[model samples]
Target chain A: MRARERILGRLRATALPHPPEPPEVASWYAGRQRNETRPQQIERLRSALEAARAEVHDARDAAWPAIVKGLAEAKGVRRLLAGSGSPDAARLAQALPAGIELVCFDRPIDDWRDELFDTIDAGLSRAKGAIAETGSLILWPDAHEPRTVSLVPPIHFVLVDVGTLHPDFHTAMQAGRWAENLPTNALLVSGPSKTADIQQTLAYGAHGPRELIVLLIDEEGAGK
Target chain B: MSQPINFHPVESFKERGRSVVNDPAQRKNFRSAMDFLQGKRRAQFPERQELEGLRDLASAIRRYSLAQLPTLLEQLERNLTANGIQVHWAENAEDANAIALDIARRVQARKIIKGKSMVSEEVDFNHRMQEAGIEALESDMGEYIVQLAGEAPSHIIMPAIHKTKQQIAQLFSEKVPGVPYSEDVDTLIQVGRQVLRRKFAEADIGLSGVNFAVAETGSLCLVENEGNGRMCTTVPKVHIAITGIEKVVAKLEHVPPLYSVLTRSATGQAVTTYFNIITRPRQPGEKDGPEEVHLILLDNGRTQAYADAQLRATLQCIRCGACMNHCPVYARIGGHAYGTTYPGPIGAIISPHLRGLDQTYPLAFASTLCGACTEVCPVRIPITELLVRLRNEAQARPDSEDATLRGSGAGRTKLATAVWRGWSLVYSRLGLYRMTSWSMSRGRALSPIDQGAWTRSRTPLVPAPKRLRDLLRKRRK
Candidate 1:
């Protein structure tokens, strides 16, 4: 407490120079967004995600679950993890074939840390929204869908509703009203985990998912 | 009132600089690495107008944050506390370490996993923890490599940038048990991933650095390409975040602009793999995330920078490391040669306040004043201008009445001071200047050929046959 007082006291004791008002950021990107159509935004996101080595599959709402199952099968995934009590998880379970085993993250991590880290072949979650400009998915981890569901697994499958896509990060934040109430953990994942740390050589799957498979649900056929 | 200086031998910087500059392999490593980075950054900012606009917004946001730093910090404390995240104040390196030590003691933590935190480096946290018989392990792939080799991070962003792949393969095989040597990057990364995964699961405490602490939302934002940061913060029971006090911003809306510029400037990424915004620890019903979260706000000489209005600009740095990558000096000599926790242009300005100017005076003079650092800074820090100011501060009279900087006039010498005074006297008087120039031109033949260090690399500094004024006069006629 004394340290806080001394530090703040020093800062308060000194008068800071008044800076000019910050520029309006909302309009700075306005010109770029003016001519871009919804389909164009989705296309931009697809190319950006593809460039980062993430696989993006455009599917209708009804066919999305089957796509995930097929992708899981193609990857030879045995035990796929899902968020317990989530509607998407329930839908996914109904769509999966009998050959694949479904694992629910029903309890606290302490109950099954080893299983999640070692045994889980893949994890599935729903992205709240996405940023088109950066090809990023926005996730807010909650009690139902814990943070590790998307992080720990070797492969991560995220379902994004194309309608929720924003033109950029600033637009996404404003549209979501994120500042009013934020979750314990909110994430913006641009690609599968990667690193260029070793001699500036690009390598994927550094610590997170090696493959990030995005199931883009285009209900309105915007990209058709 | 006294600022302790970490005095190195006077020629330590030059010696280190010479050694790195002369090594052909190391030079090739740095040259290729820097070229790759420069090209990527250039690609990210293809449109000069848009890049300038973003830079403007980013700089303004940083300035506004610094101006409101004191108030924002108080608000940050209140909100973080209200959010059930413990907040600790650290006035210096010792205070910061002691706080973490206290937390470790309470948690009875044996193993601590760490994300890449430069603040932890600033406080010597891992060393302090080791002294207390607790193991603090670095989980970032690059940091892990450097830690295994028992060395400080060579670069801020890429901690092991100084080392080549072959060297890392050698180090890993020797240090990591049961591992064979391999130069393949993917194979090596997998080895690191496997090793760190177990440590993350077993560690009792996790430590990370905060990129930006949003006061309004009581959140800590961390930007990283690897998932190590998430693992460190999530897998452990307790998560501890450390950051310099200057990292706070007043609102959450300010993050995007800064983050945009930071990623592009630092790594040429549109966005990193993960942008983690942590507001609290694990909630009651949460299945994962840390049970307890603690944030340490360390002042560590930042208050000194904040005390002066102009020096306050130093607080605007977002630690993107663009300045270092674009620096000619850093490219040739590398980060280690600077002999500071932060190296290159940013280090040259900030190290003086942290370690005192008396010992760090050489850093201010190491720059070529090329303005590349100033040009590339995401927040427009005016690095070269600050470098010039610090140089002046280091050479000012030691007892100057209003000396706010520590170790003022450490670089001042009687001979240099007298030389400057005489030069000023002669230049200010027209008759003396004319007489000196006339004699210098006439005595050109008498000029000494062996002119000391300046002549070592180039031709001797003999006076010209005709003065510049005489040449101009002849041109006019």
Candidate 2:
């Protein structure tokens, strides 16, 4: 304990510089001061949303069939739950084979209440964006974007727009404006949910999706 | 269901690797899994510029965070303690193991359900737990597979990267009798889930690894696709998190950048499925989570690495497993060949430092110095440079015969030293170099191979009739 204190003391002495807020922060505040002004953040968010939509459209056209076929192949996947925030989720639902239920939620519900809608074999949703460096899909849940669409299901399929893809973590945080108001829940999914707990055996779909498939839509390249 | 598979350390690693490499069926399964992942990652980024920019930003953040690690760690400890969580500092592997054991004893824990923690692997925590007569059950499915197989993780992110469905089926059949042997992936997963659910419910203590520790909020962040990490922290009566001291960041603001890098670089995902932030255990009136929360801050040679200006960058590693996937040597020989908890490029540099040059000398030479590992590193650590440093350190040991042989000039001490020094002097002066080259042309027919023992192992060089100096002389005339 004494040693821990000593180490802590040493650490405190070497704290990195935390410079004053940049001009952008002040500009953002100034914009907020003018009630009639168009908020730069909101505009950026809108543009990001538009870019995300375009990517999803392209992915739906190119990769929907294969994704549906893969999901259909899973043992228990009968229905897919998708979030309303994802522009592609609705389109993906329309593209699925007849009788395979794909439901989209615009808002959260009690776990028991949501469970009654359908037995979700898989979840299909659009990622807020994608990280290119690690192939991770990011999802932010809110009052409208329920967590169950990403969870609950045995297989989760995320549709990502290439325009929203960032190379590394730093860029992703910057673009997302993470420092301002972080979301309550954010998911960065690389692959299917997996666990290797019982004697070091690899098993997918332990507590979440057994399989995760992402459809990367090149909005500009595909001309969607 | 009975006893976990016994990993005999050295022999088992060779056996496991040989068997996995030989089995075509296993190879197909492993290849397909990796192929799917790589393909997804490739498809995720269409704009190369954007992806590159993100990588740069992520690398910068990690580097910056590690540079101020000591301060961040102290801040994190204070916040965690203020929130009623006990934080223990461990200087090395033994200290970490002892601390974990003491925690178990204090809680009177008979059974432990551990979430997948790489730090626990670094300290060999399960072995220590078993020695103390405590039953430690790995709750993550991938970890469970390696635990059952009695082996170590081949990949940092994917522990059972070397295992096949058939191998898993064989192990399952032996553990759970009367169960039909099936090579199907889903069947195996179902069996594992059913078995582990009971263990999660019954375990008295839960052990986990922290992804990020936020100093301002006193929160430990655990990012996972599976809810097992969540269950491990919440379901058990006591929750213990073991993590490296370098995992600390000064404020919550530092988390997003780190998260962005770790997730993207590890599996090429935008974000992990479940990013749970736990401040304390369950508060008053709370129904879930552990009653007591203990955070083990493991130094384990991290401070020593931090003290060295050249080595401090190694602490920036996020353990994303990108280096391993891209490393040609690691891809070919696999993880067990390295014989350390951490494997591949980062492991080659870190293991020798953590365990010492004597115990981990071979790891330094494990790499081909191909630079692929350095290229893919999320934090941009100069991995190849560090590996070279370790190699130099290994050669400098007091009892090193290899060093003596190289240092003694291979037999002809005086003549070799004088020749080497004279060559250096000649090279330093361009005019002298030209003069020597012109003189050498007079004896161009002499045996080049007979000049030194170093040339004895190679094909004899063709004697030059004229040097560049002689050509220059002819031009001048």
Candidate 3:
């Protein structure tokens, strides 16, 4: 018998009636702070991200680029990688300090594969939003700032507008209606890559970037 | 039925279990690790109401998905194919391994990299690949350690929980050269990182196990702390994901609650480092991900279990390993003792379905039916109830046509069956019950002290001094 036929037939033959739609999840676990102002949400997000081991820096829109440059200088990053022509990149390049080189991931990672993994000291991208509960940065990877920008390099830097911070993961997914028009790939990265595999001893940077630095752009009056 | 493979638990179940219990170091390793994991889980869900609510939602999602499993599987296959990902179905472990090997051959993959996939382990996958001259390297740190040691994973989530840091340090120094042996875990991790980084970049094919396969979007979701899972699915030219047919869910929103309960229950982490949801192979403009992605939907014997209404609850497992972590028997005996890919309470119920009663029925008896497993189960599988049901199955008639209960335990034979038959006959009838009680009370002195295995560690059970019926009458007077 065809494998698919057999497997599915068995399930079909014994299948029960479909139950009701999944109970409306009590996603309001984060609703306690629903009344909190946007600024409070940002603070909650920053604290959560910090706890997850991602360094968070508060900055204004114009100051965000300078903060990135400063982080580059601090990490001894020579060639700082950013998605070319991205909103975050345009601002960073305009404000980039002279000594540090700004390398645009202008083409596909395949075009500059060797440099991306080896030569690039760090990579940066703009996060779609931040989840305060788990302190995770959600990214919807596309052709422009592909997944690799946040993944391959030794160091990762993410930019998040303070207003984009959500109270929790479910609220973000629910509001976004992600199921309807989901991207080809979506990620929820909490911290720098870590592992406790070797006898439960925690270690960072097992494979992905060793460090995750979040540059929180605080737009004063910005609302969700 | 799952025959005893090179590393399968069937032939070596008792021996391996005995060794695991007798080895103080192994026992200590499991006890401490389980304690730490259980503690972490407890701390994460300090509020009972919140945990129970999430569990309810996750359980509903699992059950609802299973109710429409056939439709959902079809939808998943259709969506994946439309999105340019190939889907294959396997009725059993052998078929699954053969299909995976066929994919490897077509791709001419020499060195394959793998994330921690219990499904792959279920099929004795590494051994199969090696026989075909393919090297399957496990990239997950714990799995890599167990692979290097040439042993099966004792625990599902933490494959190398049986090894201590000192043991791992010793193994690394002995196997991977150029590094001086150090007991420091950070240093040991660095050594592993340096060695595995190259393989991740060079592997010809990447294989991973799916945590969830969404039917609505035709996507596979993976949760992991280390980035190896991402690298394997991304770097290789070809990626093959194998998962049980039971993993598919109805919608995307269902993932969050299930994902939340899973990590918190398994490792006591509020959230894992990464939740990667993949819908299609690298699209046309995409630069990094694999060019080809294939998913193997495996049935094994799950369909047989899924056929029964009550037994279907076993499919609700999310592979969180919480049951094992909180299992007292498992912590003491360790994972390798169960002799199945999955161990502890979940294994006991599920193994019988996949491997049949003859090979894995002993696992049903391995548990004390302690409710710790059932208590912490994310989807709240009635593990203890299932264990009791399986015990009855293990005693079913040997020639029974029931595939779900192939019945190969002590009661399957005629003598054992007759012993129960006569015993039941005496216990159920008033005249026989009175005669047996009177005879047993009068002949208490003649009872043998030794009763074989039962008397090995404890005294034989002795009859009561007086009959319960007579005592009740005296009380009435």
Candidate 4:
């Protein structure tokens, strides 16, 4: 506390005679040209996500469960983890093939830390929204949807509601009013975890999910 | 505990630079990596007009934030506390390390999984943790590789940029158990993933660096491509974030532009794989995320930089390492040659404030005053100008009334001062300048064959046979 006081006090003492006026950030930001229609936004999002090596599938809202089931079976995934209370998880459980099992994150991490880290082949979560310009998934992790669901597993399947997509980060934040109520952890995931650390050679799953598959819920069948 | 590569005399820094420059392999490695990074950055900013607009907006945001730094810091602390995240303050490196060590002791932590935090490097956090008998492991792939080799990061963004794949494979095979020699980057990364995963799950604490702390949202923003940052910050029971106080911005809206500029400048990505914005600890009924979140705002001579308006520009850096990538000096000597936590142009300007001018004055003079750094700076820091100011501060009169830097006038010498004064007199007077140039041209043959360090790589610096002014006069006639 004393350190804080001293540091702040010293800073105050050295304050400029007149604080500089804040820049017109909003006006400047508004001058940029980014007014794409919904389809164009989704197209931009798909291209950017695909460029980052993320698999983006265009699926109807009612058909995503079957798609997830097919993807899981194709990848030979046996154990899939999802949020216990998520309706999408329930739908996935009913749609999964008999050989695959759906596990819910109902227990505290302390109870299933080892299993989550070593046993789960894939994890599922729902992205709150996405940024089309960067193809980033905006994740607001909370009590119902834990943060690790998309991070710990080798494979992660995220459900993105196409209606929630925004043109860019600035638009997303302002439209979502993120500053009014930020969650404990808000994440923007663009692709599968990767690194160029070793001799500048890019490699995926350096510490996070090796694969990120985005299931776009195009209810209107707007995306081809 | 072992100290960081200590600040040595200017001669040793020069010697290290000389050795690295002479090593063709090392020079080639740096040259290729820099070229790759520069090309990627250029590709990202395809439109020069938009890039300039973004740069202007980014610079204004940083300047305004620094101007209102004190208020924003207080707001950040207040809001973070309200949000159940504890906040601690440190005035120097020792204070910062002690605060983190105290937390580790309180938690009875045996191991700490760390994301890349250059503040931790600045405060010598790992060595101090080692002294306290705790293993603060580096979880980032590049950091882990560098840590395994017991060396400092050569580049801010690419920690292991100095080593080749074959070299890394050899290091891993020798250091990591049950690992075979393989130069494949994928295999090496897989090996690292296996080792670090266990450490992340088992470690008692997670430590990270904050890229930007939003005062309005009470959030700590981290920018990274790897999932290790998320794993380290989320997996461990206790999460600790350390950042220089200058990282704070007033609102969340300022983040996107700066984030865009930062990623594009640092690694040529539109966005990293993960951008984590952590506001508080795990809320009620939350199944995961750290239960206890602590933020340490370390001053460590930042207040010194803030005292002066001109030097204050040094604090505007976002640690993108773009200047280093663009620096010809850094490309030749590499980051290790600077012998500071930060290297290149940014390091040269900021180190004087961090570790007094007496120790870092040499760094200020190491540059060629090329504006490449200033040209490429996303926030337009005017790095070359800062370097010149630092050089002046290092050589100012010790007892002068206006001396604002620690170790001011350390570079001053009776002979150098006298020579500079005489130089000013000769150059400022037209007649004296003409007379001196005329005599120097006539006496060119009498000049020394070996002109000290100048002749080390090239021929002697003998005066030209004729003065430039005389040649111009002849051409005019």
Off by over 4 Å in 1: B1-11, B442-446, B468-477
Interface RMSD of each: 1.1, 7.4, 1.7, 0.9
What is every candidate's C-alpha DockQ against the true complex, given to 2 decimals?
A: 0.81, 0.16, 0.68, 0.86
lDDT of 3: 0.84
Q: Which stretches of candidate 3 lie over 4 Å from their true place?
A: A18-21, A26-34, A94-99, A221-224, B1-12, B399-411, B469-477
* lDDT per residue (tens digit) for residues B348-432 in model 2: 7776557655566566666789998888776788999988776665555355543321121112236545877898999999899
Candidate 1's TM-score reads 0.96
Which tens-of-lDDT digit does each residue in A1-224 have in candidate 4? 89999999989998575666776777776887488888999999999999999999988988999999999999999999999888998999999988999999998897789989999999999999999999999999888789999999999999999999988898889989999989999999999999999988899999989999999999986665
lDDT of 3 by residue, B1-477 (tens): 122333445567778778878888888888889888888899999999889888988898898888888989999998999888999999988899899999999989999999989999988888888888999999999999988887878888999998988989888888897878899988888888889887877788999999999998899999999888998888788999999999999888788889999999999999998999988888876667888999999999999789988899999999999999998889988887787889899999998788777778778777887698998899989999988888877786556654355444533667777889999999899898889889999898888999887897899988888878889999999
| Candidate 2: residue B71 lDDT (0-100) | 61
Over A1-224, each residue of candidate 2 has an lDDT whose tens digit, in order, gives 76686655544554345622221222322332323222332233334433322112234346665556554654445666766645566556656766677666643242233252235677666678765444556776554445556655666666666667664444566667654444434555556666543323445677666566656555445332
| Comparison by DockQ, 2 against 3, better one | 3
In terms of DockQ, which candidate is stronger, 1 or 4? 4
Ordered from best to worst TM-score, the candidate numbers read 4, 1, 3, 2
Q: What is the DockQ ranking, best to worst?
A: 4, 1, 3, 2
What digit string (tens of lDDT, one per residue) describes model 1 on residues B1-477? 112112351449888888999999998888888888888899999999879888988988889888888989999999999999999999999999999999999989999999999999888888889989999999999999988888888789999999999999999999999999999999999999999989988999999999999999999999998899999999999999999999998888889988999999998988899999999999999999999999999998899999887888999999999998999999999988888888889999898888788878889888999999999998999899989998898779888854558887888899889999999999999999999999999998998888876786888888889999999999999
**Candidate 2: where are CA atoms >4 Å away?**
A5-204, A209-224, B1-40, B397-477
Model 2 chain B lowest lDDT segment of ten: B403-412
- Per-candidate clashes come to 0, 45, 0, 0
Per-residue error at B359 for model 2, in Å?
2.1
Query: What lDDT tens digits, residue by residue, belong to model 1 across residues A1-224?
Result: 89999999999998766756865676776755746798999999999999999999999999988999999999999999999998888999999999899999899999989878999999999999999999999998899999998999999999999999998988899889999979999999999999998999999999999999999999999888
How would you class the docking of model 3?
Answer: medium
